[model samples]
Target: MTNKLTVKIWRGKEQGDFVSYEVPRLASQTVLDVVTYVQRNLEPSLGYRFACRVGMCGSCAMTVNGVARWTCRTHVSKVVGEGQLEIAPLANLPVVKDLVTDMSEFFDKWARAKGSFKGKRTRADDFEPVKPDSRERKAADAGVECIGCGVCYASCDVVSSRPDYLGPAALNRAWTLVNDVRDTQQRERLRAVAGDAGCHACHTQGSCTVHCPKQISPTAGIAGLKRVVGRAAVRGRL
Candidate 1:
């Protein structure tokens, strides 16, 4: 095995090109480690975002060899091609600098999708009991673990074609909220995800599911949203 790896990293903002660097290859080294090495040793000016390097924060997501992944958990050995690596900011989002894309649009779409829960009970009320075995609870539990990572968003091809598309993460969050029995905004949330740029716009490419580091199936969530919205529309309640 070679002791060194060639890395081509995107430099500057959205307008810049890839810059090549030679980095040391080590045992069990991750892609984030390589980028960190380059920034700390070779080029201190290199800009990137990372927190909770163990992979929980999902802030270190990037495009590795044309695929979106969580660099914190992506092993260099698994992704190295011909002893080389290419790292860039997540796609489909505005680039802030090098490797850090603006996340405002992503969160904004989440809000537009009505991803937050609006409980019917007041703060003075007692805690609501949710049956663990109930279908609604199960469905909600299935997708409640999303960490707002952009991996699914970046991997979505529909976002590339339709810039206004609400994207997968937002739809997935909406689905989770729709299943929450305690939520009082189901009608509005369903309507929010039913528009042209909403769940109806998804092409079901499953790219979001394929690349999600959290293994959350935004495609499945979008499908569920489609069914709910369709039923509501058929009932003339949408």
Candidate 2:
């Protein structure tokens, strides 16, 4: 309810420190609005990335008050404790500059997890009939809505400790693909996600599930992956 809010924003690359800024407070103002004000009115050189201002793009996500959140959807009134805000880049990723982060490694692990779909049928083939209510379909439906916002990845502690570990998003995607009956590369996908750097590396700490803006539970998906991958390995299918 104050006229202005004290915001501390991170200002450099890998090695950076928080810099304080005073931003005018408005009703229902979002954290993205604060960062934008700092950039457009106070400091033109400030760097950040945002595509769709609405919640769909998930590009406006950042760490607000030590939690990963979609800045566009986060209301200042909800998180600005003590009339102050602390903004930082998403954790566990390489910081590019200012508020932007390098997502190369994040997507790289997606490929390493074999997250892409591979089917035996050609485009000429008729659409494969899929049962929506079936167990696999239901399971796959739960995790297919990911927009690669990296919130879950940023929230995951495993990614912070073991850099080689495949983060929650990629593993969750792999679980989705693995459950798809239309996908024929289950064996390879299982193989790709089996080792320490893959599904097995997850600590199941649930940080990803807790912070996901989409309400998707990557922890549950990773659990399902563990079961399937373990069965595959035991059956010599991995």
Candidate 3:
């Protein structure tokens, strides 16, 4: 793969155009590798975000060829066609620079979803015994490895349409705590995730689930929240 790969990347904000760059192709290189090459060798002005470079951080996500992917893990061979690649910022977010996007809206939704754990116990108190095999712990464990990247948020169609929507990642985080027997904010959390702008807004399209680099199904977890909230509301507990 020594041929020069033609890379088309979106420059600036929504008002910018796609600029082309002929990046030298290498065997077994990832999409991030190409971006790094261009930044280090071809264009130092190019902007993008990356940290672990090993797919764990999820900071290197970009629209590779048209799909949201962790560039650190996406292989060039998997996405390239005729030595050409179209790279762009993650969808559903304001592009700050080339491949970088502002994540404020995405994180704000976490607050809106009441995703934080509100515990009643202090550090001085004895450790809370949680059964690993218990239903609550099992459900919480199902989607606890989220890295807080905006990939799922960017991949969601409902989020693109509704800025007020809580989106999948935040709702999934709420679900993890929703089933936690130790969390004291259960009722309030349920209320936060109820109604049109919360869990009910999810179309269940599964784009968030499909694009999640951590393999966490936020859609499934959000659905669980919806059911829990619906049941509680019916019981007059919400």
Please give each candidate's TM-score. Answer: 0.98, 0.98, 0.97
Tens digit of per-residue lDDT, candidate 3, span 1-238: 5688899988888789898999888999999998999899888999999999987898999999889999999999999988799999999999899899999888888998888888889999998989999999999999999988888998899988998898998999999998889999888889999968999999999999998989999989988987898899899998
Task: Find the 10 residues in a row with the least total lDDT in model 3.
Answer: 1-10
- In candidate 3, residue 113 scores what lDDT? 82
lDDT of each: 0.93, 0.93, 0.91
Ranking, lDDT, top scorer first: 2, 1, 3
User: 11-71, model 2: which lDDT tens digit per residue?
Assistant: 9999989999999999989999999999999989888999898999888889999999999
Clashing residue pairs in candidate 3 (N, C-alpha, C atoms within 3 angstroms): none
Q: Which consecutive 10 residues in model 1 have the weakest lDDT in total?
A: 209-218
Q: How close is candidate 3 to the true structure, as a TM-score?
A: 0.97
Q: Candidate 1's residue-wise lDDT over 117-190, tens digit each? A: 89978989999999999998988888889999899999888999999999999999999999999999888998
Model 1: runs farther than 4 Å from truth? none
**Model 2 C-alpha lDDT versus the unseen true structure:** 0.93
Off by over 4 Å in 2: none
Model 1 TM: 0.98
Q: Candidate 2: worst 10 consecutive residues by lDDT?
A: 229-238
Question: Whole-model lDDT for model 1 versus the true structure?
Answer: 0.93
